[model samples]
Target: MTDSPEEPNPYTAGLEHKPQRDDTFYYTTVVFLVEGTLFRVPRHPFIDGSDVFRQMFQLPVPDGVEADGCSDGRPLRLEFIQQNDFKQLLKVLFPHHSQPQKSSPKTFAEWRSVLKLSSMWEFESVKKLAVDHIGTMQIDPIDKIGLARDYDVQEWLVPALNELAKRKEPIGMKDADKLGMELALKVAAVRESVMSSYSGYPLQIGERQAGHIDFTNAIETMLTTLENS
Candidate 1:
């Protein structure tokens, strides 16, 4: 009989790494949740399986979005999901509310404008609209800050600042301190932009009137928050 070649050992050679079920993976699906609900979503690009549902699958996270956050609620996160989920969320959020005013055609900027107006009026339904759909709103800190300034929404302004502050250390920006300083400068710039439109005076001269001092204080406070946090 011919001698058989020795078989390769399985223990230390020819070992293959198998990904666990919880490995980060992507899936494209219709994403139907409750009865009679459907979400239009693009194919998944990338997302962490560990925090998929809690972090990445949110309505506002644009596709292929990335951010830093744990499975638990933390500072900042970057993530994406389908547009359908976003729309479904809005429907559920404002079931009893009036439909937003129709613009000539739908555009992302239009959507932002609508939200800005709604947020300013403090209409219960409009607030609900933002609440329901803000999760799906793909906005960066600069844009959030700018929009809040342009629209004069005090409520949304500081929170966005704080959110960015909380995440600054984790965002891996080119220079954290410099980034904070730049953001402070941006606050100053926004104050300048809004000053041209300043109307309220004295007693009401605050976020509603492009008050530079207030914006400066807010930016400073955010920097402090990030430093300590």
Candidate 2:
């Protein structure tokens, strides 16, 4: 009779990625150990294991999966859990991405940071998330005059420009008139398109422009507003 390779408890294996109770909501690394046979498991489910255990073990193990796990006694599973987490984070950050105009900010600024990081890394889904969030706003002076100038969120550009001449003047615009005017024209075009697509009247431009705004500035402002005195 041939002896079957040991099927170690996935929960006990060094390759197993169970999340600690204290780290369930945050990112946590897990280790698993299997003496002979190997298998892949997901991250979040392992973190909060409930009914998923049965489903994972039921799936047939693919060839070469064992070889990959047993190499040099240091198993590195290819489940790509980080990528999955990032993808889920994108959904949380930009829920209304396709609609553009109706999306609201997620409850936490962590979502915004995730979107920004995703954009910086050129992650397609992450970029889409940021764009969707930007599209919903009325384009405050800071976004129109500062962050827009650097980050290039194309969706907000045209609406901002359309109302530029009438909107409250941003500080130190005297030196950047040409570039400002150029952006204003682009914003006008974008605004027209947005208004045509939506049923509501266009948003009004405000007179008081925010000063010295950046991504961090926006985040700080939001945090302050959230923590009312």
Candidate 3:
């Protein structure tokens, strides 16, 4: 009699692996690999705050694809992002305090990470919160300008540039490197104009008026002109 075809090994057969439900959490857990570190966080807050995550979760899973969990299950992989940045972002998204804390990020660096990830993921509220916190920090004017421009924080841009313009010392090579050559040159020019025109004039405060030399307006105009030119 013909030898019966070798039966397929049950263990070898392609099967959707599911991890044991190990955690006693109230909500479903979604796992992410950030910079090779595994973070198993709750799904609700991410889904609620991030349009990107919401869309991702709404997508139909492919046939035989296991849901995201641990290795026994499928852990969602987020590549090319630092684990610390992701951790900071999660802190903002899921704060430890039941009520809003007076202090969010203790440092500018932490807020920067939150801003980067929140903006990338289109977490608008979180982005706004990060921006607000960043606004209060004592950051270098050049760095602040960069962050403002990058994140489209319009309110931050004029003030930061004006602060740079008002500085007694001209933009150094290091700061110029941060602001790029074009912006650095523009800032230098504005500083010269402000020094010459106003002499000892204090930095303009409040909203721009019709004819007054408003540093904010000047910065805004300079930026507009640069963009157009």
Give each model's whole-structure lDDT. 0.44, 0.43, 0.76
Q: What are the per-residue Cα lDDT tens digits for candidate 2 across 205-229?
A: 2323322212233333433553563
State the weakest 10-residue window (summed lDDT) of model 2.
Answer: 190-199
Largest TM-score belongs to which candidate?
3
Error of 3 at 83 (Å): 0.8
The parts of candidate 2 lying over 4 Å away from their true place are 1-111, 168-229
Q: Rank the candidates by lDDT, best first.
A: 3, 1, 2
Q: Which stretches of candidate 3 lie over 4 Å from their true place?
A: 1-26, 69-73, 97-104, 195-214
How badly does each model clash, as a count of residue pairs?
A: 6, 12, 1
Worst lDDT 10-window in candidate 1: 70-79
- lDDT string, candidate 1, 61-174, tens digits: 556653323222232222243344334334433334326552121444545644553454333454445444543566676566666666555556676664544331333343
Stretches of candidate 1 off by over 4 Å are 1-110, 117-124, 166-183, 186-229
lDDT of 3: 0.76
lDDT of 2 at 55: 48
lDDT top scorer: 3
Clashes of 3: 1
What are the C-alpha RMSDs, in order, of all predicted structures? Answer: 18.2, 16.1, 8.7
What C-alpha lDDT, on a 0 to 100 scale, does residue 144 get in candidate 1? Answer: 69
Q: Sort the predicted structures by TM-score, highest score first.
A: 3, 2, 1
